[model samples]
Target: MSEAMRKPETNGAPPVISVRGIDMVFLKKAPGVLDGLARRAGLPRPEPVGVHALDGVDLDVMKGEVVGLVGESGCGKSTLGRVIAGILDPTAGTFRFHGREMSEMSPQERYRAKVAVQMIFQDPFASLNPRKRVIDIIGEAPVVHGIVPKAEISDYVDEIMLKCGIDPAFKQRFPHQFSGGQRQRIGIARALAVKPQFLVCDESVAALDVSIQAQVINLFMDLRRDFDLTYLFISHDLGVVEHIADRVVIMYLGRVVETAPTAELYANPRHPYTQALLANMPRISTEKQAFGQIKGEIPSPLNPPSGCHFHPRCPFAFDRCVAERPRLITKAPGIAAACHLLEEAAR
Candidate 1:
């Protein structure tokens, strides 16, 4: 087993971060009465309804655990990460940090939460300021927040750069001067400078090369162990998630479809969506799949199919799947599935 898979388990500890039935609905702007005219003129047309970016997401991250959030693009994995990091408030449902209700926190408690939860974005170069030098980019936060004295900022930044595997000599250089991997390291260093307890990594390695991806993932594991950090690692790459995640959460069209411990989910996926995803992967093992690929593209969230959101694409979907939504229910130990056909599949 990989070292990442060997990390200590939380074992049902109280959650450091918790979310229940959180809904993040975004109002996609409409183009007004010009819809027909715009279409005729080959211009952009209006949307009829709001985008359901996240619909009734429930998740919990125990302290020191790395929970991987996996799905295709536009599946709300990144939005869910943002919600957990406090970058975006949910439209509905409860969010608690260290057992304290997010909405009910005092001013100081809110500030602490804000600093404790940090986000490392997908595009490292785009996230970094072009004009700022590496030193200011990483050291400014701690200095301004009184975590590090102004006089010690340079040394502090140097220490951080070393920790993140960046050369201190590049402290004076801008983000553009560094390679993609180095820029990502700088981004990681910047997040660490704030002394965050939790990290929401939104496709943090998606832009890197295959070799670089492994290196960055290894670095994340090292840092997680060193800092005792908890993470909501969001990415579309199931291969990466399989390698690093202790627990995996799968989402489809703004809602969670399945969740399970890494080994069990990969060994036997309960949801058809999860099965399709696994089937689509390039399997180099001895096993051969009897089924073909999942058909069609994902339905637009603005008009997601009623009942089970995944029913439209599911092969085994029956009448019940088209009439009523399936709630997330436990199917086995450390496994939960949100599909009407789960029990039927088991039998």
Candidate 2:
């Protein structure tokens, strides 16, 4: 088999999806001209700052592998996912699927690329249309893309609905008629309608109850096996990622702090940010151990701290961390971390 068709192994095929140096910036609306003029006359700058949603973020997802993206709220996990799905264009970056540049693709080409990459949003209720029936919702993609004839739309929708663990009869029901978990299942069915090769699940299970969360997660696992799907699973819940992710990426303040195999990351986190994140996870153990406590609120993206963005909260931060930004360097085989401390450790 060709490299692109091969499944993920320890050191196997190149990434099916590759994102490099992605930077997404949102321009904040400036204040009135009068305010700006006043600011120019020996006052604070009145010009609106640019919000850096993603700052030079890099990631790779191999075919048929589940990669987890974990971070605090507003840490750019969802923004990255949207970029990968081609729903939101990045301010500056390269996104490639099967070695083809996603940004340069034509409309038809982009549509085809989108067919291969799909997204499952966080809020089930918000994702689905209130007026549309479940059948229509799931079949909309295939119909627009001409994947199936109008006569066969219902049949195709029924097949995927069943595959996603939803009853065929439930297709006629509106989204409001269903519970949170069921609504999520319907959303999954919609994404599956296109028979995507890659899935970007943005907090897919966060809204459901604990028991229901497991069921939804299991459905995702089963669907992956049955459909040969690769996923970019984004979540704030480290526990859920531990259960499903093959590799995990830790994000803080719009940049990746660390990336490692699931077991390796949980076992030994190199970056102080990663260490602090893992240390705070809820656990039952009463044993005394050194735990790094996260301090201070995340700085606003519009005016983020210079040098190391995490320096304000990182206990191990030093003068160099405040003066120079760190690049992600491979600290171990298949594990990379962005921290000045690692350079000393490596030497």
Candidate 1, superposed: residue stretches over 4 Å from native:
1-13, 30-48, 283-292, 345-347
Candidate 2 lDDT tens digits, 1-347: 24343337536556889999999987776567877677778777645667899999999998888999999977899999999998999999899887778768888887898788999999998999999999899998898888888899988988998898888988889999999999999999999898899999999999999999999998998888889889999999999998888899999879998999999999999899888888888765777766547788878777778899999988998999999999999977779999999997778
Q: What is the TM-score of each candidate against the true structure?
A: 0.90, 0.90
Q: Give the Cα lDDT of each candidate.
A: 0.89, 0.89
Pairs in steric clash, model 2: none
lDDT of 1 by residue, 1-347 (tens): 45654664567566899899999888776455688688889987545568889998889888877899999988999889988888887889899888888779998898888899999999987999999999999999998888999999999999989888899999999999999999999999999998999999999999999899888998998898778888889989999999888899999999999999899999999899999999897756788855568998988887899999888788998999999989898987669999877666666
Instruction: Tell me how far the alpha carbon of residue 86 in candidate 2 is from the true structure, in angstroms, after superposition.
Output: 0.7
User: RMSD, each candidate, Å?
Assistant: 5.5, 4.3
Worst 10 residues of 2 by lDDT: 1-10
